[model samples]
Target: MAKIKALKCKECGREYPVEPLHVCEFCFGPLEVEYDYDEIKKNISRDKIKKGPVSLWRYVDLLPVENPTVGLNAGFTPLVKAENLGKELGLNNLYIKDDSVNHPTLSFKDRVVAVALSKAKEFGFDTAACASTGNLANSVSALAASAGMNCYVFIPSNLETNKIIGSLVFNPVVVAVDGNYDDVNRLSSEVANEFGWAFVNINLRPFYSEGSKTLAFEVAEQLGWKTPDAVVAPLASGSLYTKIWKGFNEFKKVGILEENEKMPRMYGAQALGCSPIYKAFKEGRDWITPEKPDTIAKSIAIGNPADGPYAVKVTRESNGDMEVATNEEIIEGIKLLARTEGIFTETAGGTTIAVLKKFAEKGVFDKDEVVVAYITGNGYKTMEVLEGHLNKPIHIKPTLAEFKEKVVGQTINK
Candidate 1:
């Protein structure tokens, strides 16, 4: 039997049966999955999890599903000790939680889509769908294809060509909305109501968001069962940021880690184009105001983030903060990680890296603190953003002298 106990409203604390619901009928607040943690504690242990598969299912006892149907090898990505990147920023201990190489789809969305589709199947849904900016669409389409379910992916019309192609190759029904991500999400919400499809981030959201906890699980496990001093994650709907903090705390409650140490400070990153959460944090407000996104970080471009207030609260409670990155800084961040860590990540990651650097400059992170910055997507999916920015190939003749003049001479001069 699934360990899920109930669906609880995040605002008014009303609990309901585990069903295809995402909002409270009374207060109209978002709902979250309530698990039977006591039963989970009885079955889950470090030894038990270590013996399971290296995928997200390694923590299956903690996940909501009893029968996972997809992404058998997602999660458990490397927590790289970014010595070069750390040195560049004058920090002694910095790491990159590189989810850009997650299995099947090579993005963190694979983790969420895996669990969401599993829950969809458990609920007897024959179709799976989502309103995504890019990564989630790619993941949902690919996983649904593998599961033999009809898939529909809705996205803003201005999504990157490669991201659109990423979902198309999976042969799912693709819908391009006429406006931004918020517009696409609103339309998808209406479609979910009319068609009754298991829209992953809509009706199936309580289950879908649980997948992000695996990132935190892997990070703590990778660091020898201890939370890092700080974490920096990109904020889209702010779901990932909040879930990661929950994962660490859950581990402590289950006796997997010590609670005596200070909780990891949770920092959030956002592109200046859509920085509602950051703005709220900066103004010391408990609420967020939406913005019209206009940035290259399309993957994290949710103008009205659903969990923006919660993200702000989490950051403040953890004694952390949020920061924004400009397009120029974001591009520079992408190049810095590539040159330093050989990890090519998407604009969301660039935003994360840029904000991390800003924090380092502001003395937000102590020099010896263990900091982990998450890189959520592969840069290959957004190569168009680097068209004129990256160095082009040097044209030269076949002759050795010509090669020397064009290539070797340039190298020598540099």
Candidate 2:
């Protein structure tokens, strides 16, 4: 494992010792993990990575943990060519970095939870916790179970039923707060400080976020070690978007990708109900103004995102744009992907696909440019939202007459 040299404050440039800390005591800004890239470049190579495990642990050289207890099978999801979707949108080259099929938990949160729990164990903590909208709670609960650690997951009370049950099945103590995700996060932060337990998103954030980089790594490798022209990812707290940018840069620094390779435009997708980052980007502001989320895409419904500013910075720095999808658009996007690619994704993925279509319609993408859109979760977890929206199946009698009359493409008389 590549040892972290320090935890550097993103705003003030102050460095602190490697420990379970997130905020800078002096500046109150978030801190990020700084690794010794020189040491990593010594033995980290494409051949070494390809020879490693078939999971996210294949990039263990870049991850923070030495012995990952949980996610030995979390990363390296498929980067499908998306020919059907591309044809529908009139784009020649498009791909979907599908994480909806991720193991243990059918979402990208499994990647981050794997690293966080490993570090929690490495730090000798037996309790794991987090504040989540939905997917993070499920990932944390499942991984903590595998690691034999006590787990607590705090989430918004209005989360989908399957999401609540998904975490409960893992046997974690689940807390449903009365308010929104931001409210749950605030209480979790206090509990993290008061109870002295490792809250993955609050205290162990720097290490946990490194897990998102594997998404970028898999994309570049799947594209034959080349960065795409653009990438569209759903923005919740915005940590995932920024980390993907960091991941591409890290690969270039380590000689995996060429130093002169053009970086991908880091596009962000959000629900119109809660799009602080998109609002900031549109108004040409450097800071974010919080909003109250009311979208069906509850997973990316953080009204006050902690990493909103950084997400804006990364988007501008990479010459990227952000877009929002309405509730109707989100639902259509979910059905579109299912009909075209046979991938049934949650609202977060729907938001991504909807934004991708908007961008394509606006001619934002070159016909030949490689565009990769991320689908972060499976639709099965949030099937409740599809009620009264999807086309109902046909009902027929169990007879050959009915089979010929209604089942074999027979026109129904209404």
User: Candidate 1's residue-wise lDDT over 193-241, tens digit each?
Assistant: 8997999999999989999999999999999988999999999999999
**Candidate 2 per-residue C-alpha lDDT over 1-414 given as tens digits, one digit per residue, 9 for 90 to 100:** 345688999989899887899999999999898889899888799999889888988888888888888767898899999999999998888999999999889999999999998999989999999999999999999999988999999999989999999999999999999999999999999998899788999999989999999999999999999999999999999999999999999999988998899999989999999999999999999889999999999999999998999999999999999999999999999999999999999999999999999999998999899999999999999999999998778799898888877767655544
Q: Model 2 misses residue 260 by how many Å?
A: 1.7
- Taking all chains together, each candidate's TM-score versus the true structure is 0.98, 0.98
Clashing pairs in 2: 56-75
Residue 61 of model 2 has an lDDT of 83
Residue 179's lDDT in candidate 1: 99
